[model samples]
Target: EPEVTQTPSHQVTQMGQEVILRCVPISNHLYFYWYRQILGQKVEFLVSFYNNEISEKSEIFDDQFSVERPDGSNFTLKIRSTKLEDSAMYFCASTNTRDRDTFGSGTRLTVV
Candidate 1:
């Protein structure tokens, strides 16, 4: 099965540095989402974008985070000002609908 894949599986960043996590979502899917898990915390939705515009976004997607679909297969999340609290597992997911979705292996962000 074709699944989403994220690069660097893990990343360590310094506070206030910029980080861009890459993802290749499933082809033929229309919806893309960014979700995060802060250590053992519950999965939190950050944002959802489709058709070249943001569809939905949670409060967690603040001024520091932005997402872009630079190509047909690539989706990227950029954090402009990483904070110590930003350390978490960032997962990229895609869905044709709520019933069908795939999640990437995830990039573990570590702020030091």
Candidate 2:
């Protein structure tokens, strides 16, 4: 089965620095998204992108976060400035239709 793929499986960063999380969604998928789970906390929605524009975003996706589809297959989330609270497992998901979404294993971000 095809799946969304995330790179750097894990990343260690310093506070106040920038970090880019990368993902490659399934070839045929049309919608892509980013979500994060802060350790034991529930998974929180960050942003969604479709047709090369942001379809929707949550409050957590403030000035600190941005999403982009640099090419046809790659989707990226950039954190302009990292914070301790930003440390989490960030997941990438994609789907061609609302009923079927595939998620990557996730990239774990550790802020030190």
Candidate 3:
């Protein structure tokens, strides 16, 4: 079965630094999304992308955060500046239909 893949399974960064997490979703899937789970917290939706544009975003996806599909197969999440609170497990997910989603093993971002 096709699944989402995330690189650098874990990352550690200094505060105020920039970090980009990468993902490649199932080829046939259309909807893409980024969600994050703070340690001990529930997963929260960050942003959703479709047709190469942002379809929806939550308050957490502020100016400092951005998502892009530089190439048809790669989806990326960039945090312009890291903060202590930014440490979390970020998940990449994609789905062909609205009913189900396949999530990548998260990229754990740790801001020091």
Local distance difference test scores for all models? 0.93, 0.95, 0.96
> Model 1: per-residue lDDT, tens digit, 6-105?
9979999999999999999898888999999999999999999888778999998989999999877899999998999999999999988767689999
**lDDT score for residue 84 of model 3:** 97
- The stretch of ten residues in a row with the least summed lDDT in candidate 2 is 94-103
Worst 10 residues of 1 by lDDT: 94-103
Model 2, runs deviating above 4 Å: none
Model 3, residue 81: displacement in angstroms?
1.0
lDDT of 1 at 95: 88
- Over the stretch 1-112, how does candidate 2's per-residue lDDT look in tens digits? 8878999899999999999999999998999999999999999999999999999999999999999899888999999879999999999999999767999999999999
For each candidate in turn, give its C-alpha RMSD to the true structure in angstroms: 0.8, 0.6, 0.5
Tens digit of per-residue lDDT, candidate 3, span 18-97: 99999999999999999999999999999999999999999999999999999899999999989999999999999999
Cα deviation of 68 in candidate 1 (Å)? 0.4
